[model samples]
Every structure is written in C-alpha cells, then in structure tokens.
Target: MTQNCFDDGDEDDVPEWADRVMADVAREVRRRRKEMKWSAQDLADRCEAIGFPIPRNVIANMESGRRAVLPLVEVMVLAEALYTHPIRLIYPVGYVEEVQQLPLTYPVDTAQAMSWFAGLNEDFRADHRMLRHHVAHRTAVERAFFAVHSEERQRRAAESTVDDIEQAKALRTQADLAERTARAKAELYQVRSDIYADGDPLPDLPDELVDVDPPEGYERDTD
Candidate 1:
C-alpha cells in the first residue's frame, strides 16, 4: 500500500521510517539473491521481461541498502523467476532460523570454520589454488566434488578385477610351459651324452664270434 504523502503538501528530504524499511528490504533482497543463486544480471533480465526495466545498477543499489523497495509486481516476478515464494524476496530472514536448526554438526574449531567461510568469497587466484589443494589432498572438498562419479569408479574396479584374474592365469600357464620346455631340453642333452660317452671307446663286438662255426662240410662229416 503506497501512501501519497504529497496530500500534506509538505516536503521532507527523507522519511525516517521509509529509510529503515528500505534498509530492511535491501538486506532481504541481498539474502534472497544468495539463497537463489541469482546474479544481478539474472534479476535484471527478469525485471526487463516483466516490463519493470530495472537496470543492473539499480538492482545492486536495491540489494546494497541504497534504494527503497521495488514495485510489488517486480518482486513477484523476481521470486517467480528465482523459483522461490514471493515473500522470500521481501523477508529472506524467515529462512535463517531453519538453516540454524539444520542437523549438520558445525566444525569444532572456530578458526577452521572461518577458513572454510573465507574460501567461499575468495578471489579468483586463491579460489583456483584452494581447489587445486583440495584435489591434491583428497579432502572433503574433493570427496564432494567426485561424489557423483563414485559409482563409475566402482564399476571400473569390478571390470579390472576380471582382467587381472585372466592375466594371472596367463602368467601361470606361461610358467608351466617354460618348465616343461626346460625338462625336455634337459632330457635331450642326457640322451646325447649317453650316445657320445664323453669320447670313451665303443663296446666290444658280439660274443657270437667266440663260437664261430667250422666249415659246413667238416662239421657234417664229424657228426
């Protein structure tokens, strides 16, 4: 409900209550932007589409305590485009209590918690370095980064186990073949050694020579 103060025909540079209301509205809008992940450009685009014609600088002003409330329809459009209830754009603090009541256990060390908070708004260079370290150290940040891909890793491990087993069987078969080849080679050498006799003399002739028969005719006459 916009009241027409001009009816009194008295001009005040700024109204005290209006100033406080603007401040509260600005803070709520800022908080809602953070919650909805909407950039100034996103809000501007929505306002433009809804015939509000809000410049990005005006959105920034409204979100930084520099401007009063936007028109009601503009707030509604922003809420709809951000996929949130319209009241949230005007009173984002409503969600703070719920966020505080969440079941997550805050870190015990205040310094560690502050460090994590600082990383959220870090400069681009520090952000890159922090992400690199997070991956290199396999910290919680890295785990959360890869949570979506963990199932794929498990599947790959399962397939690799099958290949590993086949490779092990192949190695064992190769070892067995090598052992059999070595034994056959050894037996061949032993047979060759027996034939050569290490340069020893050959065995004597057959003992049949000792009983050589006389002339066939003389043997028959004696009988």
Candidate 2:
C-alpha cells in the first residue's frame, strides 16, 4: 500500500538520513522566514512574485513537517524571496565555512562565493561601497599633492638665495614624508579591498604619493 503525504512511514520505509535532511530544510525555512518577520502567506506571495507560485497552505505544510519532499526549484525560489542563498536552506550550518574554503582562483568559485556572501549579509555590500569611495577620494587628493609639490620643487630650483635653498630642502623633506604616508595607506586599503570586496574592482590609486589632510593653519600653495 502507498503511504499518504502526512503518514509517518514505518521505521524501515524511510531512511534516517532522508528524514533528517528534510527536517533540517524545514527548520531553516521557518527560521529565515521568521527572521524577516514574514508570514507563510507573505512568503507565498513573494515566491509567486518571483514566478514560482507556492501557496500559503503548502508553505504551512512545509514548515509544520506535513510536507516532506521539497523540490529544488521551490528551494531556489524560496531562497530568492527570502534574500538568502539556496545553500543556506540546504546546509544551514556549514554553508559559509564550506564556501570560504573553496579555491577562489577559479572564476566560477569566486562568483559563487560572492553570490552566497551577498545574499547572506547586506552590510558587506554597503561596506564595500563605502570603502571604494574612501579609496577614490584619497587617491584624488594624493595626485593633487604630488602635482603641487613638483611645481614648487621646480620653482625652488630656479632661486639662487641661500634661504631659498634651505626652504626648498625642507619642502622636499615634507613632500617625501607625505608620499611615504600615502603609499602606506593605499597599500593597506588595497589589501582590505582584496579580502572583503573579492571579485569587485578597486579604484586605481596614484603610485607615488600617500593621501594627507592639510593641518590646521597650514596654507595650501595656490600656484
């Protein structure tokens, strides 16, 4: 005799592993839905919006353990609606660690990891945007500093006064120090961008100088 949908089969009929996996999926679905404060009907609505129409009753059945077999398409659509990756629904415990361990040199691996990461944490995307902006602004400032200092150096070289020579030396020293500082910062920010914004392009920073804000009461050379 065929077992009904709600029937708990005899111990011999269903393998322990299958039961455990289904239960895990159901629990994960319920947990993520609750995290977003979405009701079963809300989830159904969202799935329908994404072109996979799951009814509210089916959602209730899945969460309540009445539904045992979850289709892959349903899992994918449900994950999309929940703003999470399908792996999170399947392997709630080890998905992040497993994805992190993948070799990122392969383009496919990198793409998959990024997609998973984006779905899991919205804040990561926001942080990446802010970091990119900071790097760009610093790069512009460093370029301006170099251009200004180079013009000043040429002007100082043309002056023959002893006072002018000493002042030129001081200016050169200051410019050298600032360049080193900016280079160090750019390198650090580049390393951070590589790790956190994997698969995204980072702003190209000027090679020569580091970025520095002018000190209070210090007048910028307008020439």
Q: Cα-based RMSD of the predictions, in order?
A: 36.0, 16.4
Best by TM-score: 2
**Model 2, residue 53: what's the lDDT?**
98
On residues 10-76, what C-alpha lDDT tens digit does candidate 1 reach at each position? 3342354355335445666666677678898877887788776678898898777667566777666
Query: TM-scores of all models?
Result: 0.32, 0.39
lDDT of 1: 0.47
Which residue pairs of candidate 1 clash?
Answer: none
Least accurate stretch of 10 residues (summed lDDT) in model 1? 98-107
Q: Which lDDT value does model 1 have at 190?
A: 38
Clashing residue pairs, candidate 2?
A: 182-210, 182-211
lDDT of 2: 0.60
lDDT values for all models: 0.47, 0.60
